[model samples]
Each structure stands twice: as structure tokens, then as C-alpha cells.
Target: MKINSMYPPGASGGIRAYASATVDGCLGIRGIKVVEGGRDGLFV
Candidate 1:
């Protein structure tokens, strides 16, 4: 997975940012929520 675009949220609270993403370079996702927490660190 790769982040195609990322920008900080206009408001603060649970979500930290909004983003678009791709899997193996294909445009397969959009409006994905990015948040903190998880053993690995970040949860998409």
C-alpha cells in the first residue's frame, strides 16, 4: 500500500488526516482515514 496524497485535517480530534491511497501503484482507494494506534503504530 502507498499513500497517493495526504493532508492534515481542518479540525482536530480522533482523525489526524485525510488521504488517498493506492495498492501496488493502482488507484484503488480514496478518502481513507488515517489515525494513530496499533502495535505497528499507524492504522489506515
Candidate 2:
């Protein structure tokens, strides 16, 4: 599986970022996770 991250060009209303993942170079999935509170974190 491979994963990549992408940041919004500017403000995204409430979304901060996005990410995508692919498995076996065939199927793929994308989404975001919201952390209520944290100092440092990773999206994917």
C-alpha cells in the first residue's frame, strides 16, 4: 500500500488537509481524520 498527503491551497472552510491511499496499484481510498485536540499530528 502507498499513501500520500495533500494540503488545501487556502482555507478549506473547516477541512485542514487531505490524503489518499492505494493498494496493489489497483484500488484507492481517500479521506480525513479530525483530532479534537493535539499539539502535533499526522493526517495519514
Candidate 3:
């Protein structure tokens, strides 16, 4: 499944919300976990 949003990363807008939703969906799949870090592709 493909998901797209208009919110920016960690910006508390649609993008961030979409990311969180995607994470939840990914987790729903057995043995699948979407591990994401950093901020907007930059290392933390």
C-alpha cells in the first residue's frame, strides 16, 4: 500500500500525522516495524 501526505516531518501537520499513521499500519503487519530516526533526513 502507498501513502502520501502534505505535512512536513515533525511539523505537527498532515505530514507528521501521516507518518505516524504509516508507522501504525506498518506495525500492524506481522514482524514488520518501520524504524525511523533523525529529523528530516538529518542525523539526530
User: Which portions of model 1 miss their true places by more than 4 Å?
Assistant: 36-42
- TM-score of every candidate: 0.58, 0.40, 0.18
Candidate 1's residue-wise lDDT over 1-44, tens digit each? 98878999877666779998889986678888878665666687
Q: How many steric overlaps does candidate 3 have? A: 1
lDDT, each prediction = 0.80, 0.59, 0.34
What ordering of candidates by lDDT runs from best to worst? 1, 2, 3
Q: Highest TM-score among the candidates is held by which one?
A: 1
Looking at candidate 3, what is the lDDT of residue 32? 28
lDDT of 2 by residue, 1-44 (tens): 88765556355544555667788889887775433234665333
Pull out the clashing pairs in model 1: none
Relative to the unseen true structure, what is the C-alpha lDDT of residue 26 in candidate 2, on a scale of 0 to 100? 91
Compared with the true structure, what per-residue lDDT tens digits does model 3 show for residues 1-44?
43433334454322222222244356432222233344644221
lDDT of 3: 0.34
Off by over 4 Å in 3: 1-29, 41-44
Q: What does the lDDT read for residue 32 in candidate 2?
A: 50
Specify the poorest-scoring 10-residue window by lDDT in model 3. 12-21
Best by lDDT: 1
